[model samples]
Target: MKYPVLFSPIKIGTMEVRNRYVVPPMATGLARADGSPTEGHVAYWAARAKGGYGLLIVEAAAIDPLGKGSPWDEPGIWDDKFIPAWKKVTEEVHKYGAKIAIQLHHAGRQTTHDKIGGQPVAPSPIPCPVEREMPRELTTEEVYDLIEKFGDAARRARDAGFDAVEVHGAHGYLIAQFMSPYSNKRVDEFGGDFMGRMKFPVEIVKNIRRKVGNGYPIIFRLSGDERVPGGRDINDSRLVARVMEEAGVDAIHVSAGVYASTQYIIAPAAVPPGFNVYASEQIKKVVNIPVIAVGRINDPLLAEDILESGKADSVALGRESLADPELPNKVAAGLTEEISPCIGCMQACAGYLFDSTKSNISCLVNPFTGREGELKVEKAEKSKNVMVVGGGPGGLEAAWVAAKRGHKVTLYEKENVLGGQYRIGAIPPTKQDILKAIRYYITMGKKYGVEYKMGVEVTDDLIMKENPDVVILATGGVPLVPNIKGIDNPKFAKAVDILEGKKEAGTNVLIVGGGMVGVETADFLGEHYHNVTIVEMLPEIAKDEQAAVKFFLMERLNKYGVKAITNATVREFLDDGVVYEKGGKEEKLTGFDTIVLAMGAKAYNPLEEKIKGKVSEVYVIGDAIEPRKTLEAIEEAARVAVKI
Candidate 1:
């Protein structure tokens, strides 16, 4: 009764989903390179299903050999050999009272030759604006053949025990490429006019319906608006929805943005929640099929509102589900506050996907996302008194985990507040969602019966007095004030101080260093119409940030008229200006009312060495161990706490 609409069952074709919640397809890169599901994939999906999600749409699986999105481990339905692996996932999901669906995908021009073993194919020979690789225009015969390939994929999905199959026609993939004039410039019947452009996807739906039968559920996911200048918009999507509906599509899952508008695709915290709802609403009016709204629809209340307002029949949780797989169960039980909020940092999720270093999707706040099978909170062999220093994310998580495992935990924070640097990190524009995450941890600590002692700085004497069996130092970090000339001047302030409101910047400002903190600071200051200039010693600004985040940050900076100078090393600070070296030349850039140093932080582990012998077990986590991202800090804390 808490969320009747959200918990209400809905019929998609002949199948009935238990609720309006749908886990839309998101690429995890958790499969084998040969396009087979790994044990990780099986465990990941099963956990979400067991968590009470009504329906789970598995991540995109290529329909053919050349359609694979990345050179890495993206699942595929091209081969029957892959069916058994996906069948394992569907069977596991079904065991938990959930209906499972698979998204049949084709990368088209979005992929590279190195990825698919040949040049990527598209509706036209034109290359993608971002990828900039010319694709071999699919011959008319090849286009029909590709349609049959989609049918074959749908058939395989049914054979694999999936209740429904969603066609991946969004986010600048093959179907989207053909629909958008921006990507599809071909004069053939598959392109050109609106109906011509939509011909490919319509035929695809018909082909899928033919293979899966008229009664089989078919979910068609498409970008309601490509968000590009000349790209397909909601009006076009409305027509496409009608066509697909007439072509036997069961439900329409509406999302927004193409790859070029990448920020709108994954959607960082900077983008507001329910961004694609308007688009879904527009499409819903034109079509009778159940319309599912996606894109930053994180909060359960918002999902309920969207459904209650008659915007869409279903709400698709993408990255939000990754942050907390048990979101549905939590909401259904009226334990909404306990639901871990997706902060939308995108650090481990989209960040890893774009970075190519750590491509396996994971959550920033939830450490047990991908490793549900491996990383579990088992009860400790013996109860222990745990002393956690600092009430930042790391300490809070450690305390919560330890206390949940039946340990007596005391969490100490030198300051009155719980969040450490995270509070300052959330001070940036559109980043207030982070405070929700901090509040969740604080609530978890209290719920787990952690003894929270505010304004209590843990020292050697305090550790000895408390006499705890284990001590975790999440003392966090301090600003690294580099030993530069004139750096001690009072006019220069730390980035954290400005963000924390302890210090203020003037109208004209110069920030030294262009890391995540510095860039976010510039954005925060830029919002106030401050004239900001960023100087970075690296080749690129915000180099340490995720690609999509950095892209949006740079766009914001440009919009705010913030200037950036990269590969410029600051030598000294002047009373009126800053001196730096760039390309072996000494340059003096003068004209700043105040100077800010966002040169990153140094680990603050003062108590670790002091309390080593005082405690039975000593562990260091978070910035106290080494300055790292929030994801690493929380994960490290959980990893250490669970074992203890």
Candidate 2:
């Protein structure tokens, strides 16, 4: 095999998986209100197993109703009534010759009163900084009851046909609360020193072993480093792993971060992929059990290197699994380029999971992630001649999906290169992932027989000549040219022009906006030794950007010494800089050698009106209808393509 260690079979206790590929526990938020696994959830897990994963660890299942920590639709094993529904999921996964495990968890202080119906419970009364709610400390007697609940949950998982049970002692959950001194402030046996903090998870593993018997596998997952102030670090996790091993855990799954340190929890595109393998290596030094490393293990070669180096027994793909469920199968078939890569945008999965209005999670790259049951692309009843205008992410996705579904698709791009604005977006540092996605779409488009007509303008006459049955207008957006006096400088450049290498700004560059594109353009320029200053009308910069992504972006901005002027707007463009309004006062800065407009974008549906009534079935998708991120554009494209 090309990836020998990654594709090798490994045994965790009595369970011998088909290969080392693992899909670690990730909440789908597709369960019923009663906490039963919905058909979508069942199909989601089964699809991963069928994709050639050796084992799939289901997301956090509450041990009690009040333990619900995530979405309103979190899975549960608190009652035996939930077993039959869970059994269906495990049985379906097993049909693909894959072993399945369930992670027993309690949200503890991470939850709110609205979620658990009351004050949350934890090892101490300390309030979680992120949640900002004080938890009611568990009584000594109640702590013992919770321990038994963990054991009972494990036994129930076994009965539900799961091959193993994972104790969720990570990510500031209930078990982690008892393990971390940052949260465990009690003076009882469950608190105090390292050994005391270790007692809760240790006892839970022992109880699980007693209840489930010795043969059933018991995996204990914990954060090697909490990545917070005064919280447990690698030294503490090294001890936690050894103690869990002594308590009879069959394997050790190492993850990182708490709620406050969620950048590590769901590291954005700015964070390096497979950056936490060292944590698994640290934990592996102290424990004899198998250590499964998980932290953006997106690439097959990266997973293989971790295994070959003996740092981890297996690697877990989390959100990357959502982006492409068939990653393992594609890798095994040597079709790695065909696998759609996760761009780490986090707009859909983390964004939707946290939004109360959203009941389920989906992927920016693959919208079929959560809607696996109903969102599928089979051959169409009758092939249609599809004309896709533009070659941005939305246009590429629509062309690929439509052509894959038995349609004759011809994608038209006015530019010679594809990816449109997305290609320019990938020019900033640490943004190669975005380029991978653009390439993936193009490759998939080619594979599915999408005819490429680059540098060809799609006029109404040309459309009528081709006589396409359907017209998908993904003609994207254009830079919003603000209406300011003296703004039409002959040398002035749009942010996209700077990123596209069409314009070169002077050493002292003044940026006119502070949105995602504006800020990233500053970073791109700052790297080239340019003095950058961003001016925004809003109080904050990149407010709409993902939190984790913004965290890293702001750090880089500070490192590059880029100055930001917020709550300000340029009233008049000057010869060098501009006259800006800030706090009801006008100020002028004239030292800048060049001024660039980063003032966001507006919908550029130039052909939508001209061809709408002319085409029989005309649909304006993506930025042609609205100016937003590639997330919504591709999501709308996927929705339209499957129907067509």
Best model per TM-score: 2
The true-versus-predicted C-alpha distance at residue 237 of model 2, in Å, is 1.0
- Tens-place lDDT per residue, model 2, 86-192, is 99999999899999999999999999898878999989888889999889989999999999999999989999999999899989999999998889988889888
Give Cα-based local distance difference scores for all models.
Answer: 0.89, 0.90
Candidate 1 Cα errors over 4 Å, as ranges: none
User: What is the number of residue pairs that collide in model 2?
Assistant: 0
| Least well predicted 10-residue stretch by lDDT in candidate 2 | 606-615
State model 1's lDDT.
0.89
TM-score of 1: 0.97
